[model samples]
Target chain A: MKKHRTSPTTDSRYKPARPFNADEFGRVRRILGGKVLFVQGDAAVAYGALLAGCRFFAGYPITPATETSEILSQLMPRVGGVCIQMEDEIASVGAIIGASRAGVKSMTATSGPGFSLMQENIGYAAMTETPCVIVDVQRSGPSTGQPTEGAQGDIMQAKWGSHGDYELIALSPSTVQECLDLTIEAFNLSETYGIPVILLTDGIIGHMREKVVLPEFEEIELTWRREPTKPKEEFQPFLVDSTKIPEMAIFGTGYHTYITGLTHSETGYPATDSQVDHHRLVQRLCDKIRDNRDRIVQVERDYSDGDKDTIGIVSYGVTSRSVNSAVKMLRQDGLKIDHLRLVTNWPFPEKEVAELSERANRIVVPELNLGQVYHGVREAVAGRSEVIPLWKTGGEMHVPHDIVELVKGGVK
Target chain B: MIVRFAGFGGQGIVVSSYIIGKSAVLDGKKAIQNQAYGSESRGGECRGDVVIANEEIYELEPTNYDVLVAMTQPAYEAFVPLLKPGGTLILDSDLVVTDKKLEPKKIKKHAIPATDIAFKKFGRKIVANMIILGYMNTLLSPVSESALEKAISESVPKGTEKMNLEAMREGIRLAREGKG
Candidate 1:
């Protein structure tokens, strides 16, 4: 997080004229010159991490997501950061937590099986209030079902795979540009709330290549973890007021910070048996995100101009692209349809979906898996509108023709 | 326009489509490039698709193609049927044996022995994709020649750029001469 740090450049004499890091960031800006870069979604995530001031990355290589780590391994050192290929996904998550504890922005990328292995540590990160980013480029799974194909089966696992009932932030990106933009936002939200943020991308979006313009350096905004203002002797690691987010003291900052996975009080020590302390600790861990949902949750409402005759479609990730194309086709045929694209999948956009239900006669949920997000949408709709599930699996995305046909039939 | 490049994994099918997508963007158009293949690195059936548009491309994956470039027999058989009516089909003549009975009416077909030409001229069959790209661009003009040349120069292996650009020019010459 050092703004004054110098980039390791080949030419020692050539220093950056601008204030930003020159070696990598300046070269990227100069070369691209606001031109579109044709790159895979995975590469965009890696670029997003570097732009967001993430200096530490640790991950086990997996298909679809391996490209993210691969690109970062080459780019991280150029920006004077450490990128480690850990032996396993569990160790990968552990390493990032340690790095974030040391006060450097950290991240890890993985796919389904690897993501499953990181669940315990994810819970630990939440309990320890570590600010780190985990990218899960999803694949067909229950196990290693299909390594190369994309699926949205892990939407539920992202929020509930861990043992505890704690809440976290998860974002879903449908396009390559969003892959870059949302990943940067993931780190910002993680640091802002002191939580482990999950970036839920899929194999399709991760593997696909598209043209995207990298944001100029001046346009980028980074969020760093809040530091304790008190002196080292008087600092309490978990102390907080109305914000419900503690100020983190770096590991070597001479502060007596005791971080543990066990439920702790404001002083950051074990309180394993005290029920009141455990409830208070867990409630704040979940409340910090829940109370800030208005600031956190983002939902894109498309064609809201659709009248009462329009059918409402709710989707996220790669599946949402099909919904977008399908809505266009249906609208062309003089059919009205509204789309709710959930950019923030976890703090499910219940209020917005309920609002959409009130406007439309029926709602459709299209997902890559069989009814993961559909159930959540139904619960949110609360029978205000009929919720229909259009599920497809086996790696291929739902085609726009299929969505059009389904919605067209609903019109009848 | 939606174009598809179909071949085995080692034939540079994916990179060829990527070059077109990049060239289109360089020419100030929007494009998306995507592919489907087995886990194997080589000798497996593969297909890469690119969608280009002046406006935003809502279709992430296309079901049919406006143009098809088939580099192998299986690839031709698997994808040619998906070509839109009145679309164009290009194939490597030495590799794919076309059946007039199965070919759709009102469709233009161009058969170039790209692999043989690559081996004869460039001494490398891997540059066939560049040749097909040149021929396709000459016929369709989806992207400018300068953009295509720049994309190939930036995309190919460092030392191979000169040979790839030469191969592309040969295809362009062939198209101009109406030889393939």
Candidate 2:
């Protein structure tokens, strides 16, 4: 296993993003210094991306996610960064990948309909090992089911939307502050793993306004992808060390780098005819993330007194907020229950869910969709506990009373 | 405290909830504000919700509102029953006539000609929401007056803050004189 670094690390050879004016930076810091900002989750994501050193944004306007691009368009020009309204979602993702290849931290924000259109390029970014961020503010969907309403309907599509077996990282935020904090985390993780990371927020959280206090700029940790150390004459863009992550050589850096969506060899050239080369390339793409699962996966667990079997609630995104409130109501009624909230949903956090199953007699998985993460939890439990799913759709969030009533009724 | 503001889309119904939520946060309380998004075009029925608490608020949308401010009859008829028992209801007397059958009898109800006052005093009917917001805040005291004024000044459109603040003060005077 690779040694985990606690603080963000940037390769010494990598060039840092251009700094904005001192007066402007200080003004932002002062405004956010202990002052509670009542801002929508979409605006919070834009601020987070700006703080994360993301200098380029290319996105088409979509409900629940349009505010992010709108805010970025106003702020990015002030920081001397670029923000463009792409022709469509495909072009938006394509532009970000091109920007990333040029060595700039780039991102795009869109809803489910746009997300579906970007899947091909998302896969292209994964295969080419380009780092970028994609913000999917999920609305009720299955072909524009409800554009403005919130839903967790895209849980499975997020992981398998692209046609591939590549490992991906997706982080879900339940609160407006997390929309800001986790966007930065998504960028850092994307850089660290050389993969496109998804900030999977929903319309409910995306449009809701709440209090947020931004930390001082100096306190924020940021990670930059490792740069190639070898001279231009000797550099192999696809070569890797024991870490299995290749050192990225930015375009126009005098390094002869070749990138393609096709399976390639260590020299960064297509080796489509050889099964061995394909296997080696694909395995490293997947293993680079899987091997670092311990570092990438994060979850929050609540409840003490794990000595006996209790009711366990598993949830993610905005649905987790309902779970939190329900658990409090249940505990007040003298019910023994635990809660596990998934902050990083892509890697699945199977071990944590499995452990919760051991401590609880029955697990309740409440989601905005008809049962997506519930299936994953059931498989992770593997019969150690009974898995019950509370499925809700049509975009209204699960109220605390819904979960409380279900638990009180003792219905499967 | 949970409050809902209901009116036509262009009546600043959502902005009223946002201002109160910001004022609560300024007063050192946690607050969350949300609004019904779609079908909120001008002249369409709209509603905005706000929840203020000293602790972390887990509920995103409250089913029952402690206070409901209705500026139109349709809005009043649609959301009156959602007011909790013994809750307060503030209505625009010029626009909404209450139906006794639809409202909770135990609830406290107050009427003010907010739109008429805004049109007469401020010459802009859009400022009516500010008057209603001030009246509601005075009756409930959900946030400090200083915080509410600051939030109002910051939240209203630039150059219109003075007029909006004046309208709000007029509302405060009305409530003090037992007119609301």
Candidate 3:
């Protein structure tokens, strides 16, 4: 478990995103000193990428998540980076992974349908251990159920979206501020672990606005993939060195690295031989994330005491925001309760959540999806506490008042 | 506070809500504005909602709206039930002629001659939305005049800022000033 740190550091709280200027480094370094700006959830997703130093974004237009792509389209280009609206979502993901291999921070965004289309590429990125970020602004539907709606249905898809056994990093933001911070974190984890990071958001949080104090564009730190200082011939793209990360170099950079969707060795050439390289490659792919859960996993608990006297609410994304408001309302009405709003959906903050669930009267999981996070909550607590699932489908976000009713033992 | 504004095509209803929305943003309040106008070049029925509060607002749609501003009869009739008890309902008296069924005491319906004032007084019917926004400011008083002026100045593209600001002021005067 690696140490986890999040942003919009206290200093950035009071700062607004300023235009580019001189003395920016010192000013921004000091400015991230105050309160964090509040913005809508999707804006936060877009901001997270911006803060993470993501310079390359290729995405196709899709609802809900389109705002994330649109904001990047405007901001990335102005910052001397490239933002391309590709022909479709698959091409968008393909471009992002390709750009990431080129040693630049890159990301692509989409909704549920587009997300489904990107799964094949997601598996390829996993097998190849390519580093990048994918933002899925979840909507309601198995297939275009609701365009102008919101849903947490993609929660399971994000984890299992790409077909594979490899663990992933999927952070769901309930507010715009988290979007900004988590986007940066997504990039960081992607680079750090050598895997594609998913920043999951529902339509409600993605499209809604909240007060966000964005540090000037240049003020935020961005991490690009580390390039090979070693000569091209000496580089092993999938080398099983101690660091578990290769000195990545892009194809056009004179690195001459072989690229493929097939299983390959450290040298980048496709090989069917499992004894020498294939086994090591797959293990490293999984180890990259499994080994760094702490640094990669991010979660937050508000009023989570885990007492039997209190019925706890577990939720993420927009549901978490509603739960926060509902908890406040319930408390005012004299109902004792606790709320755990998950910022990171995958990597399931097991230890902390398990500890909290042990003593709580009940753990009620509410989400825009049918019952994705509830599965993790149930497995984590191991039935120590009652695991109730409050699932919502389509795009309508589960309101806070509804959560209050559930907390009082109204419905699961 | 959740505020919903509805009107017909080219009624400046979206523009009116934007003026209020931008003013809130200028005042540094946590504000969010969402518009649902038709994709058609010519609008059939267009509507938008603005949510502003000291704390974070989760609901996107106006729930028990604090204020309702409408430009056409359909706009007023559609939004009447949504008004919270004791909420303020402002409309373009000249444009909205239909009698909508709404609780008179619970909801205060105040109609101002927005089109008449814009066309007859300013000789520019296009500024009717700004006029309605101006009148809205007088009744709601949620945002400061300086902030609204600043908001209008920046929000309305560079060339049209000055005229829109004046139209806003005139609209405010029309609604705020006492009966002659």
Candidate 4:
């Protein structure tokens, strides 16, 4: 029998420091003074999460979103953080929520089916007011419709996936660079509002490779949840301060805090049956985001010199790319048109949409799903302008010619 | 510049476009690369599209290719129509046989025996992608030759750098001599 020697590398518990040179990890590079990197959007999110001081990641592997976890698994350890591959999506979100409560930034990523599994725990995080980031890389699904294809079918689901009347922040990123930038913003928003921020991306943006210029480490902005200013005895975890957001007490800091999914009072005690208390609690939760809509919503707009013939196009995520190209092609033909690309999907920019509706002769909404955001556009426009929806499904993205032709037909 | 690379799944079709896109980025240009393919791991038709520009690239997918790199017959047949008028077409002469009568008018064509050269010179067909990249560099100048070579050395698998570089150099020589 041949003698087998066990190398140190054979030990499963032993992780090599700096597994490869920084240059070898094509996923990201910050050396040589801000050089560009060609990386997938998923990898960019992972880098963004790392840069935003996210110290804990618990994720269950799923298609399209798995790369995010894989990159984080390799990176978190190198940065003195921890990444766990949980048993299921529920446990994944649960673990991150726990980590967040322990005074660390945490996150979880999943696709449509896995996101479905995480809904209840996401609600738990919401009720407890834990700050954590959840990434839903949307794919075709009512229930596991297409595993490997791309779709923006979860725009509404991101807002209402959990039960109850609560508000959360959802951002849609179209480019690889935006994937990095918006993920940092998502974490900041979550930390700022004490709500779970959703980085809602599609399979195309999640899996596609593009050139990204990563900001320097010192240039990145990071925010943390507001901590209690009062003493441990007087600290109220759910008290609505003047900021409309409650301050959180760390779990092991000698503060007596009660955290529950039940409707709770300002002192963090469960008030299961009191309607007035329930009303106040839920209203505060919703109002924290609602009152700050001006600061929360981000939209990119381009107008066509007040041309009467110009139409307004509203799009987000991958569909925004096609809409942009279509607008350019139409403009080359002297057909005036403008576009509003929604970077923040939820806390919908109704005011901006209404303004565009008032200006343009017609408003065109294009998306990968069958008229999800279009409904919101129509509601915002409210018969002021014709809201035409160009919807496509079944994993194929809208070609530029199709969108341009639709606009042309409308113009005619 | 919008470029498309198409071939069978195992031809490193995605990697070729990826390296080119990375090269452009290293040269301080914006580039985006997207790919589509069937479920099969090796035999399915694979295609990749890359766009490089001085400004931000808003179009995620290419509408009309400025350059088309077709490494197989099926790829040439499928993508030739999508090439812009007067665009450049790069072909693997050993794999793609063009019908002159059916070819699009006014488009410049540069055909090279990239696969044959990779197999004959380096004894590995996988390096054909690097050869095509080298040939493409001579035609389009999408990125500098040094930038592409740097991207290749960083992208390919370990220990195969020598063979891949040799293949690329051979391709550049063929293009320079008008031997393809």
Candidate 5:
């Protein structure tokens, strides 16, 4: 075995760059804008990250998700950003966390197997309250089941994969345009809440090419983590503020903050033994997201008529496209139906789901997986409406005709 | 409009749909293109699907194709049934032989020897897909001529624009004269 250097500067090969200025941001927009580029979903995500001001990327390539890292590797250096292909998925996520803590937006993209490897670090980021993004271009898997086939099997994994109780934000994109737009939203949400945001796409969307009209930089809204306003001596890294979020202190900014995964007090020292400290830290972690759930969750609703007899269909990602088309055809046939598409998957959108269930006589959920989100829909409806699941798991999308047939027959 | 290009792998089937999708976008229409292929690297059946619409596309994949471009006999047999009634069917006359007795009567058929045209006229067999695309351009003008030309130039290899254009024009000429 070769002996490796252990020094901080030598052990880690890439140093995090400073935040991008207006000129650098302008260059990124120019590189991405001006024309409707017919590009793959993975390329759109890479460009979206650059436009969202991500200056650091660390990832280990996996099938279906490799294009994201490949494009970033070529483009990051051109725009004064850094892309590092780490040794493993754990190291890839760890490096991005380190970069985020250094006051730069950072990200990593991977598939199911790589995502499984990154869970420990994902939990670590949550414990440390680091702001970063992770893109999981999902593939069929329990353990590398299919490398190239698309599946929504990771829907539940994305929310509950990491151990311990914590809140997560996940957004699913159906189109290549949404892949770009939602990626930018993922970065913004991560920065706003100081949490790890996951853009849960799948193999089909990752590999498919579509027409994407990117907006000008001036029209796009961007948000960054708020800097600490307190003086160096008064800085408390873990203190909950009026907004229920702690302002972050940059590592090299002379704030002298201690960062660790252990349960800690407001002063940032490890308090692994104290029950009250652990309780406080955990509660803040969950509450920061739960208290602001109204502002964080996004769902698109379309109703044929505001009537209680309609059959409501709930879906997300690529499956939603089939559902939308099915609903349109059913409506043309004089059937009453509607659709509720989940844009933000995590935090569950429990309230919206419950309200829709109350108005809907029956709710149908079609997913690429066996029945992941169906369980959530069943629970949220709570017997107010009959919940049905239309599942397909053979690495194929549900055709609209099949869905139309199901809706016509109604739930058994 | 939903169109499908089907052939064995390595026939540029996927790229043909990609060019159509790119041209649709250039024409200010919403478009999406996706593909399905077998695990084999080459010679396996492959299909590419494109959906172009004046409004936002709700269905990512077409349930029934409005136009079908069949470049191989197997592909032609497999996809011809999925073509909508009265839809246009473009086939490579040299590779796919349609059964007139059993074939649907309502469809409009345009059979062109795309491979022969490419090899005989452009001195390359690989440009057959471009030739087929050029032939389809006449039957269904889903995108403008200029937009299709720009999309072709952007999609093909860096230094082969001139030869590909020649192949495409030859295909257009065959379609204009109703020649197979």
Candidate 6:
């Protein structure tokens, strides 16, 4: 059974024991500015859709993530947007893809089980090179273990969830504030790369409240799924230029285009020839993201001081915050601990990890899931430096002290 | 100045904490509010922590809590170690039966009949969270009495606002009068 954890916000029992300070609260609130809000990660996705020019949302109610669909149900109608709660994850994804094809920015959100269910469709999106956004507010998985708790368990799934050799772009946020910011980034990357970008969130980062300075509407750069400049008879959705980014045209927009799950050419028709347009189309999908990597990846480094000889901790999602906590405390104690917090989880951040691993003898990768991202880190750092994978599951975040102790123990 | 509150899920945890956070933000100080909850909705242990620092606060949880409000025995027992030695622990006398093993010379635990007072005087079980919040003013004079009162008045529902403010004022009165 795929048991899911539902976040309890509307419950009457929700209460806090202490008093609050709004003006003092406003200080940090002003940082992100107008977009600032104390919201869950699911709601953050809904807002990200609004920011990303996404006009449609299709999703089923999945635990630790149902609220994203619920918020969309309420907010979509007001924004001239459409939200459909389909029967299952597969259908949910199908609706979003169809909506995107018919010329609307679209998205869907789910957890591990739903993500697993959507794998075939993800392959379809990848092979077809369709531009869309899929958000997985990751939870404990394999067979629905713990739902409400947070986990970075889906790092591997985000990278290789679909059973094919396709390119994927995933973004992991460390806080609720980043949830909003990164979801927008996911939408941008999805549009820019013409692939389905995943806004990867764990239970903790999705729901935790941090002062988010919301950017005003004007500050956000919005991109539409590209439309063809040529006449309707001469349109090709899969055609690519020097940037390897293809111009996407809607179905009903006077451009008669046919899109399929099979490898297709620039003319929107399937092809089996490996030497011709088939290989070229596939390569474009990979290069549009893999080649223009720097513009697509965002990683935050703390206390690095540009030296890696000191213990370096690499983490993402909620565990990254614990790493930050551990790093901040270690720095306060006059310890040289450099931390790499990966906001962009996909494309694996191969270059930066290699750069950091060279100077530092000790490197720790602490995650909420069991060794998913650890493998990626190990592969990137290779055997030149020590890449330790510390993972915890079943509804608990890795403590900062444990991360610090792990780093210190690496020295011993 | 970070007022970090931790308690189990059903102990009016987020409500009382949000009231304080919302009030603090209105008072013009930079504030950050956060909560931690388990899977279960009602009885799961939870914590609502707020940071009211003068500047930006990168740290999320209040590891060093300034004012700790705990209603259940487990909640108090869990967070007492995180206090900065001299921090205050306010426990509801009704829900929490065991005596807090607090340091008399350093950490002082104030026992208030909060829920009982609400049930008897206010005739509402939910007001217990408010009664203690009202009494908190006595120990915490960092924010002004009027400011906290204004916070209470502005918060809560329209009809209940008056009664909630009264409960908060009574808390202030009790705190001012002391437990003699």
Taken over the whole model, the C-alpha lDDT of each candidate is 0.87, 0.87, 0.72, 0.84, 0.86, 0.72
Top candidate by DockQ: 2
- Candidate 5 is scored at a TM of 0.92
Predicted chain B of candidate 1, TM-score versus the true chain B: 0.98
lDDT of 3 at A102: 72
The CA root-mean-square deviation of candidate 3, after full C-alpha superposition on the true structure, stands at 4.9
Preferred candidate (lDDT higher): 5 or 6: 5
Per-model chain B TM-scores are 0.98, 0.96, 0.90, 0.96, 0.95, 0.86
Per-residue lDDT for A262-343 in model 6, tens only? 7776777877666676677766667777877776667776645646477778888777766767877787777777677787
For model 5, the stretches where C-alpha displacement exceeds 4 angstroms are: A1-22, B38-45, B97-107
| Preferred candidate (TM-score higher): 1 or 5 | 1
**Fnat per candidate:** 0.81, 0.86, 0.31, 0.69, 0.81, 0.28
lDDT of 3 by residue, B24-84 (tens): 8668876777666665535678876777777766665445688888778778888777788
Using DockQ as the yardstick, the better of models 1 and 6 is 1
By TM-score, the candidates rank as 2, 1, 5, 4, 3, 6
lDDT of 2 by residue, B27-59 (tens): 999999999844648878788999999999999
Query: Model 6's lDDT to the true fold?
Result: 0.72
Model 4 lDDT tens row, B25-123: 888888888888888979999998888999877667566888999999999998898888899999998899897665677999988888887888888
**Ordered list by DockQ, greatest first:** 2, 1, 5, 4, 3, 6
Candidate 2 per-residue lDDT, tens place, A1-412, comes to: 1112122233333343334444654565553344468999998899888877788999999997999999888888877789999999999999999999998999999999999999999999999999999999999888877888999988888889999779889989999999998998898888878899999999999999998877565756667888888898989989999888888989998998999999898788888999899888889989988887878788877754744678888889999888889988898898987888888888888988888887888888999998899999999999999888999999888989889988776574
Winner by TM-score: 2
Off by over 4 Å in 4: A1-34, A307-310, B38-44, B73-77, B80-87, B96-109
Residue-by-residue lDDT tens digits, candidate 5, A1-412? 1112111111111111234456777788787756578989999999999988898999998988999999999999988889999999999999999999988899999999999999998998888889999999999888888898898999898889998888979999999999998898898888888899999999989998988877675656677787877898988998876677787899999997888988888888999999998988888889988987887888888776656788889999989888878987988899878788898899897888897887788888899988899999998999999888899886778898888888787443
Q: Can you write out model 3's per-residue Cα lDDT over A48-99, one digit (the tens) per residue?
A: 5655556799998987777777777777765567999999888989998888
Evaluated against the true structure, the overall lDDT of model 1 is: 0.87
Instruction: Kindly list the per-residue Cα lDDT of model 6 for residues B29-78, writing each as its tens digit.
Output: 55556676887768889888776666555455446777778788788777
Per-candidate count of clashing residue pairs (backbone under 3 Å): 0, 0, 36, 0, 0, 39
DockQ of candidates 1 onward, in order? Answer: 0.77, 0.89, 0.43, 0.53, 0.68, 0.30
